[model samples]
Target: MEFLQLKYFQTAARYEHITKAAEELRIAQPSLSKTIARLEEDLGVQLFDRQGRNIQLNACGRAFLEHVNRAFMELDNGIKKVKDLAGMKKVSISIAMTLPKILPKLLSPFLNQYPHVHFRQIMEPPSILKRKLEDGEIDLCISPVPFGSPAIEWKPLFTDDIYLIVPTDHYLAGRKSIHISEIKNESFILMNTGFSIRDLVDKLFNEAGFTPEIIMEVNDPETIIGMIRRGKGVTFISKRDWQYVSHLIPEKIRINDPNWHQMIGLSWSTKKDLSIEAYHFKQYVIEFFEKT
Candidate 1:
């Protein structure tokens, strides 16, 4: 029933280990256990299923945890609002993105103008970014793919054409444009499955009625480019990213299909009220894209 009890329960549910949660909470294990027990007694439901030292959140616990999260979020929002009104807190913006390489260009100028503002940038896969936005964990998300949730609003920032990259000495490197089907037999160095680019490229391959021979799967763009430069395999890259790697002088051939481009967008949760700083940054992002 107490705020502290709910906090303890939320932490315990997160880790599913009483000792670990107690350690994080900086409280004694026995005291934390007693607090959770009192909370369960007050609620008249068993929150966690226990097996010796192991603990699992039951269905009731999961349901209650959702409300507990919202309660904490509301409390945090209220505090932030009060501090903003009094001009007592520094401006802070938290953003999650799948494309972290684009941050320097966007953030540098914005920070130059508002030097006092603090930014927390996180790099996550598109799926995890969507969850983070919905959970009120991030103020905004910039991604190549839309979250497609009713509670989230997505605004297209820009679209970049995808190109097939290969070593300069490769036979196909002489081509200006090529259909995806023509390269089905070529070895591919691709991003891992969870990445947005990987999903987009996979869909393109699926639609083209061919599965590419992927010889390597990597998480870093630099590594993919390096492999392609070494004639290890071919891969895809966006036109926006081409500028960064063009100096390496790899062959960048355009995909013949018109739909091969990727749309990058900005997204925010409609269910959560944006902080003043977040609102300004959102508008700044929109304007930044417009001017570009």
Candidate 2:
């Protein structure tokens, strides 16, 4: 029988008296009896034994009631789970990130406040991250906005100046300040081409009228720091990223003259619709970094 019929049967079976069931359900006694009869016919089973004006459930009716009760209980549990998820008692967040330092500083605070929210993180370049946002692979991106796609929207989170990172005992490490042009002759550790910070470095070198002595290329800021650690080559990174290299921070950092600041932002797809949870999380990130 259908849910409605099962429901009517459940009520009638609970009372075990058609007259009382009809009164509780606001229906006529004959109508309730007819519905129950129709239900019994559909299931090909006799549900009750009638004795004058009273009723008692048959053995088959007792067994069916047990299963119906279980089914309704499961349905109720499933609905509760959906409600809890909507209320954020159970939540998930997906982010595309480019740098390690900024992510921990931003993510730690959120996780502390919401330990229940499941976190999913992916490290990707700006181009791939942008594509992920469009395809709904990532809910948000803490990355640079790529050129030529106005469909991406960015909320300026922070702008950090780039600093020259030299080996601890290197000559430039002792400098009070240096010019970008002076570093032209030194070997360099560059980020991969699609990264936005690389574009900034290239522009600075172009303006200084020299090519960097390209030594190595790596995807992440940490790898670039690793390269610098081995004296593979010097590199540039935002002040935010440089802080994470605490052991090397002592003498390796020197701000170049005419300090250039690249803006880091929280980016999401402008063309795609944002869910309430994603929208709230994005807003939280903006306000969180805005304080710093």
Per-candidate TM vs. native?
0.69, 0.67
lDDT for every model?
A: 0.87, 0.77
Question: Candidate 2: which pairs clash?
Answer: none
Candidate 1 residue spans exceeding 4 A from truth: 1-88
Best by lDDT: 1
Give the clash total for candidate 2.
0
Q: How big is the RMSD of model 1?
A: 13.3
Local lDDT at 3 for model 2: 86
lDDT of 1 by residue, 1-292 (tens): 8999999999999999988998999999989999999999999999999986579999999999999999999999888776764557677789987666678998999877666678999777778888888988889988787878988899999998899888989989779998777888999999999888899999988888888899999878889888877889888888878877788856889888768988989999998888876887899999988888
TM-score of 2: 0.67
